[model samples]
Target chain A: MFAQSLVGAAAAVAAHLETLLAEHQALPVVEAMGYATRGGKALRGYLVLESARLHGVPEGHAIWPACAIEAVHAYSLVHDDLPCMDDDDLRRGLPTVHRKWDEATAVLAGDALQALGFELVSDPRCHPSGEVRADLALSLARAAGARGMVMGQALDMAAEATDVPLDLAQITALQAGKTGALIRWSAEAGARLAEVDPAPLTAYADRLGLAFQIADDILDVEGDAAMMGKAVGKDAGRGKATFVSLLGLDTAKLRARQLVDEACDALSPYADRAENLRAAARFVISRSN
Target chain B: MFAQSLVGAAAAVAAHLETLLAEHQALPVVEAMGYATRGGKALRGYLVLESARLHGVPEGHAIWPACAIEAVHAYSLVHDDLPCMDDDDLRRGLPTVHRKWDEATAVLAGDALQALGFELVSDPRCHPSGEVRADLALSLARAAGARGMVMGQALDMAAEATDVPLDLAQITALQAGKTGALIRWSAEAGARLAEVDPAPLTAYADRLGLAFQIADDILDVEGDAAMMGKAVGKDAGRGKATFVSLLGLDTAKLRARQLVDEACDALSPYADRAENLRAAARFVISRSN
Candidate 1:
């Protein structure tokens, strides 16, 4: 049921956003943007749908903001692959944008995507009022900009240690910047689409984001490159510390279970409304990628 | 009187947006952000005020949106100065952000400014509805992003030859893209803030933006590099075409007067209400930088 809903949300966003990109941006840039978008696993998007379903958000009504969330996620991936940042040559079995085009074009394309995301998400008709949409857009951007994503990058760059041994809290905070922030944003945006109080959803997101990162660490250690469809063991190679690096593999798995359990407990108040999210948490640790 | 109103709008935006930036983004980034923003003539901010004043928009109601327009204009200048774009070394007499910080930092700073702009512009109490604020915010982003400002840069890059004369229509099209688009968006957003129609003001903006660009071209030809604080003779140096290059100095000044006359004529219906704008058009030709 959760998988079906996830697929539904992703499809709706892809279809609607194609029209948006074509209409609002230049044609060549739009085509390149579409290529960057098609490479994602739709994991973050699925979380949005599953969270909204758990909260009883109408899919049709949620489509607009959902598109925005997906666009932001896509843009992050695109920018993360740039030469000045990650310098990654390939991603998810495709040539990364920096490799496909020059670095400058990729930069402009990614920048446009980020702006486009906020623009789409802030469309007021999707929310209860223009004020609510404005607030949501502010929250989303705050998460993605200097206070959130940029801060995370700056931390990673400024880390004095060659292999920083981050404690659980530090790891969580870093991932919150690197990955968790966007994950939480997607879920929160979904709840906003339903016009629900975001306190419980935020708690759910806090645990969910860490579990996703822990699972990523585990997969990097255990999963084969072919199964991952991207680099495995690349994190360890870079001396980029991970949860598994901080904790032994056995302990890291234990920590993942603990985080997922806490996440499930957070959602228990909603009963079956959160079943798909519970399943998603289980999927996070168990999947190869 | 026009200068005072323009400065009022710019100062109001600078003061309020500083708080928003400090609270959301880090103090350091905001400080650096402040550094980049403090350097402009606040021309965009002035346009918002002049139009607002022309339409009899109350001073209190005018304060919020005018600030929003300035933030957007500041963001465009930051991004446009990126080495990948204009490769501008100085902006408003200070080293460009990309030069002061890393290229990546400049990129993120630009992103932060754009987010900051939307947040300020979309503040709920400032507008009647979330939809209205969203429309205004989106219009600003559309002007700043690929199909508008970015596209203009791309076109300018491809143009290459400064000596080749661009015909009247081509010159107008380029000016509309590079200089006029954002100016036009500013008028429309201010009109929205007043809950007034932007149609009548289109003629005013159409002429206002051209006169602005023509003045810029004239400055490029006759102005001193030390005072302008940017690379001079670039139009002739790189062979990028301009109105003065195509029409020669005499005809270019004549055309500028024609545009200014048409712009003021468009405001004839407003009379004393448009006095500030009439003063602004007169001031444009006399600006040294």
Candidate 2:
């Protein structure tokens, strides 16, 4: 049931993104942007849509923030794949933006996509209230800026300079800013859009984000590169620090299960209305890709 | 006289940016953003503040957009100077961000600064009305996105691949997006803040932006590297087409003068209240660097 809902949310957000980008002139940057945003699972968008549904926010109002998060996520991937960054050639079984076009196009496409994300959230059509739009933009900036995703990227780059691998606590802190920050923001977006207290959802997100990372680490160790659509076991190959490196494989799996349970428990106040969110938590740990 | 006001605006915006960025954790990316935003003319910020003054907007409300434009301008420069891009070593008499830090930090810093620009424009303290903030953010996104600055950058990159230099008309159209879009947006920001018609300032910006590029071309032909803090005559050396190359040095200067006259004439409705803006038009063509 959760899988079906997620797929539906992904399709809706994808269509919305396609339409929004269509309005832009048919420049190479625009073409690269469309190419870059495609083929992702759209998990972030799904989280946003589901959370909004849980709170009874209309789909019309909810789709903007959902597309906004997915745009940001796609941009992060585009930049992260740049040669100066991770230097990856493939993502989702396709050439990365830089590989498909060039480095300049990749950089500009990612930058423009980030701007588009802010534009979507700030559009009046996204919500009737200006305050809500401003709040959404502000929170997004926090999640994606120096205190959030960029911070994690910076730390990751800096870590590559030192021979010493990060300890478990250090890796956790780094991941919290990098991957975990966006996930938490995605989970809490519905509450922000609905103008409700986000504490419950935020609690759920805190656990789910960490669990998601653990699953990613597990996948890196055991998952197939063909299925993942990119290289796997890269951390282990590079002697880089990761959860699986700190904790044994069995122990890491156990921790992810525990985290999923805690994430589900945090959603108890919403009762069965949050069943999809609960299932999402479980899905994070079990997904093959 | 206009130069002094511009200097003062630069100082005020710099101080505000320092304070705003100071709140973030003292990470390398934050430090790079501060470094990137400093030491330029801050002409864009001056345009925002002066335009707001012409429209009788308060300084408190005006500073947010003023700083926002400057931040965006700084981010563009930082990215444009990356090794994969323009590959510059100096800017504003200091090492470029990529030169001072590593390439990764430069990329992350530029990305974060862009987010900071959106954050400032969307903050509630910038305005009481959410609609006003959203409008500012939306307009800014358009100016800075694929349809605007990014579009120009993409064109400029594509132009490099062709053996033939861009013709005058092509170069003009390219400059309109690369530099003119932001200038036009900055000039009209006050009217947006006042929620009044932006026609007069928009007219002024249209001419002023073209004139500013002409002046840059003139400077590239004759200015000292010490004052400009960047290599001059590179366009000529590379045989790249420019206003100076197409129109010749003397003709470019005359054209810039003509544009300044038209830009100042556009401000006739504001009369004495627009003295600073008129001086700005004159200053754009006269400054050596």
Candidate 3:
């Protein structure tokens, strides 16, 4: 049931993005934007939809933020794959944006995608209350900007340039910004939309985000390249310190499981309505990719 | 008087941006964001401030949108200076962001700056009305997104790759998106904040934008590189079709003056209160850089 719901959320978000991008079909950058946004697991979007459902927010109102997060995720991937950044040629089983088109197109497409994310959330159709829309845009900017995702990325790049490996605490801080911030935002979005206190969701997301990163580290060690659709074992190849590197593989897996349990427990306020989110936490550790 | 007010606006905007950025001072990308934003003419910010004054909006409220536009402008310049884009080495008499920092830092800084733009406008402090803040964010996104500035940039890149020179109308449409959209947004911001019709400001800005671009083309042909603070005659060197190229130097200058006159005339509704904006239109054609 969780798997089917996740698929449904992805399809809904993709369709919405398609409609948005279709208005600018003539531009190559727009086409590139469309290309970059396609085919993600849409985990972030699923988090948005499931969380909104728990709060009884209409899907129409929820989908905008769902698509918004996916756009942001797509943008980060496009830019992270650029020659000057990660320089990955393949992503999601296809050539990266820079590989398929050119660096300029990749850069501009990434930029436009980011802008589209803000546009989606702040749009009047996103909610009836202008305050809600404004709040969404503001929080999203904070999550994605220098103090959050970009700061995390900068730290990651800095770490790679040095010989000294990061300890567990440092690595955790970095990943919290890089991956954890957006995931937390996605999980907290429904409560924000409903104008309710987001403490429970925030607690839920913090654990979920840490678990997600740990799972990613484990996948890098054990996952198949064909199944992952991108390069695996890159962390070890770069001599980068990750959860798997600091802790033993067994310890990392044990830690991830603990995080998932904590994440699920935090959702108890919603009781059974959060089953999909609980499943999502389990799936994060179990998925091949 | 006009020059002094413009300088005053720049100082105020810079100080505001500094306060906002100082919170993340430890990050390299945040530092790069500061570097990219410094020393521009702040024409867009001035327009926001001046237009707000005309509409009886508070300077405090106006400054947020002003800083927002400047942030967006900085991000564009940082990305545009990348090796894959214009490959510019110098800007405003200083090394471009990509030249000063690594391409990765430049890219991340630009991304963060773009997020900061939305954050500024959407923050509750920017306006008492949530609808106004949402409107600002939505409009800024549209101006900066695929259908607007990015589309124009893609077109410009496409033009360079092909042997066919863009004709007058095509170049006009291209500039309308490239440089014109942001300018229009900046000029119309105060009216939006005031919740008034932006028709007159839009009219004034449209003519001012065209005149500004024509003047840039004129400067590229006739201006000194040192005075302009960047390379000059590059448009002709690259065989890029510009207003001066298609119309000849004399006609282009004449056309720019004519547009400036129309731009000033469009503000006649405000009478003497718009004298500074009128002078600004003249400055667009007269400035060295």
Compared with the true structure, what per-residue lDDT tens digits does model 3 show for residues B18-77? 999998848778889999889999999999999999999889889999999999999999
Give the Å shift of residue B276 in candidate 2: 1.1
Best by lDDT: 3
- What DockQ results for candidate 2? 0.68
Candidate 2, B248: how far from true, in Å?
2.3
User: TM-score per model for chain B alone?
Assistant: 0.89, 0.97, 0.97
Q: What are the runs in model 3 whose C-alpha is more than 4 Å off?
A: A128-132, B128-132
* Docking quality (DockQ) of candidate 1: 0.38
Highest-scoring model, DockQ: 3
Per-candidate alpha-carbon RMSD to the true structure: 3.4, 1.9, 1.4
Q: DockQ, in order, for the candidates?
A: 0.38, 0.68, 0.74
Q: Can you write out model 2's per-residue Cα lDDT over A137-218, one digit (the tens) per residue?
A: 8888889888898888888887888999998888888899899888888889889878899999999998999999999999
Query: Candidate 2 or 3, higher TM-score?
Result: 3
Task: Give per-residue CA lDDT, model 1, range A135-235, as digits (tens).
Answer: 66767766776677766665565552345556677767778887778778777776766667777667878887898888889998898877776667877
lDDT of 3 at A114: 96
lDDT agreement with native, every candidate: 0.71, 0.88, 0.91
> Candidate 1's C-alpha lDDT?
0.71
